[model samples]
Target: MKQTRTVRQSIVVSAVLLSVLFFLPLAVIEPFRAELFGRETPVEESEPEVGKLDGEVMLQVLNGDMVEEMNLGTYLMGVVRSEMPASFEEEALKAQAVAARTYTLYKIETGGNHGDTADICTDSTCCQAWISEQSARENWGDQADTYAEKIETAVRDTDGQVILYDGAPILAVFHSSSAGLTRASGQVWLNDLPYLQAVDSPEPEDAIPNYYSRAEFSAEEFKSRVMQAYPEADLTGEISTWIQNPVTDEAGSVETVTIGGITMKGSQVRTILGLRSACFEWETEGNTLIFYVTGYGHGVGLSQYGANEMAKEGADWLEIVTHYYTGVTVGPYTPAALQAP
Candidate 1:
């Protein structure tokens, strides 16, 4: 059971997002349909025969120019395969399935953002990454059947289960990994969601690929990058004094950093420098600014590697989901409105 949070705790900051949860697990993306750059595309709404089953929830997934509709089970399988490694513990895969399903429902409830063309999209930037069976097979190679079974079993076991907060679907966002701790939703986004709070995420560094990386930019290159984003940044100085006064959260994610005399969020700096995550240390080597980054994606909600580790430690799917997501319940949900008439 979750402890009753104090009034002060309810208004804490949140950490936003990334493509960290899906696809490569190394990239970053926001939940729902909001995306970096201009990921939303205008596509022709095609007339489709949405063959409705008795109680099955259907999904319209925009793949490039085409919108493919499939039952929730099939879509969850593809999403799980694309979002997480099939070789992970079955429990971890199950958790991912539940998270994906909950996110899908939340999107539909919030109204389709991809115009009238799709309820969601294959673009990881826009929504979540989805791979077709053929594509998944090609990627899995000889182990395709085994991998497919693992993912399918995960979806089957979870069935129509979703993680709900107060009887409504919670925004089940996830990330690849974190710097030992997960971030709250407000630290990364505008809203500090009650379920998306910072928590203990015990993902070891070495186990996660690209968990630690270094980026070196010449003083001139760094100035150019900073100038393009923040023209007010005072880059005219000793390169060593360029970045100062970094305010960090309990999760060790930089909340704000004074860069070149301009105050900016750590996430903004991550984007300006193409850093893997906001957890970073910097130094000046000669005329180059070197940043040593730790972890991947925005540090919020479920940590994919952390979930896998928890599963490895014998936590079930529900336990894993509820642990990272804070207050939530796992159960079946097919609204009367969505059922076949």
Candidate 2:
């Protein structure tokens, strides 16, 4: 009986000790485990970086002989507002923004025409036209807010974007309209840029205001203008013999003509006569010389009216730019890459 009781007591003591050993370590490790788990709080995610103009661009605005420095985005808004009609489609406005940006960067990289002090000038006859938001609003009048918002949206949507050719910014020249086609760079300018070659621009003639224009000058006025530029010309003959052997391009723009025995390019004549474009048909109506002209501007690159028509046809900005520019890429604009060596 005594042995049985002693064995039972020993088993009971072993059971108590085993339970104590198991519970003691858990008690000791509870605080550390809690601390380890507490240190593992959920990590917060960071927000994405928004696209913005890398740096400010200096603009030598010819407003009251004042130079205005502005961010590239702001400058683009002003340029788009001034260059393209704000009533244009959104995609067309976007395309204009990219072209304007690319042109500005190209000028900046090429040392522009403003010497070393100014990056660009605001004169439309020289560089691209630019108008302040205030000026644009005033010009827009009752449509001010709507037009301003449209231009701002275009600039913001195309922020930091530029047109690139061969990994460099291209000379993105644009015009108001074309004579059913854009002129090749060689035809209009001195050198022919490969990307600026002639392209068909099929848009509604009625889309552009004053697509066709007529200018009549008296024989004496014509002779005076022509002789003023070329004083050595022989103008003692009849009007029919005075202008002869006119050669025209594919788009019907006068390539060259003999005026009083002096051959002059159509561009020179356009400049001399203050005609709308080089594409003109002239006839001697009695003593008055009448010129029927089509299109407006130099017609070397993108046509703004054509762009609007394309946009109306559901083409995006990228599509419109690539279509007009030819074999160029649209890429992000980096100020560092545009710096002059």
Model 2 lDDT tens row, 128-236: 8988888888899999989988888888788778899998889999998888888888876689898897888865788688899999998899999999999988887
lDDT of 2 at 323: 90
The number of clashing residue pairs in each candidate reads 17, 0
Model 1 ranges with Cα > 4 A deviation: 1-55
> Could you tell me how far off, in angstroms, the CA of residue 131 lies in candidate 2 after the best superposition?
1.1
lDDT of 2 at 306: 91
Residue-by-residue lDDT tens digits, candidate 1, 1-341: 14446543554422122232345443334443445555676788542121223127766788889889767777777788899988899999999988998988888778857867877877888788888777888999999989988887788877878889899888999999999899888878789999999889879777889999999999999999999998888888698999999999765689899988898888889999999999988999899999999899988888999999999898999999999999888887776555544
Model 2 Cα shift for residue 262 (angstroms): 2.0
How much is 25 displaced in model 2, in angstroms?
69
lDDT of 1 at 315: 97
Candidate 2 has an lDDT of 0.83
TM-score of each: 0.82, 0.81
What's the distance in Å from true for residue 250, model 2? 2.6
lDDT of each: 0.83, 0.83
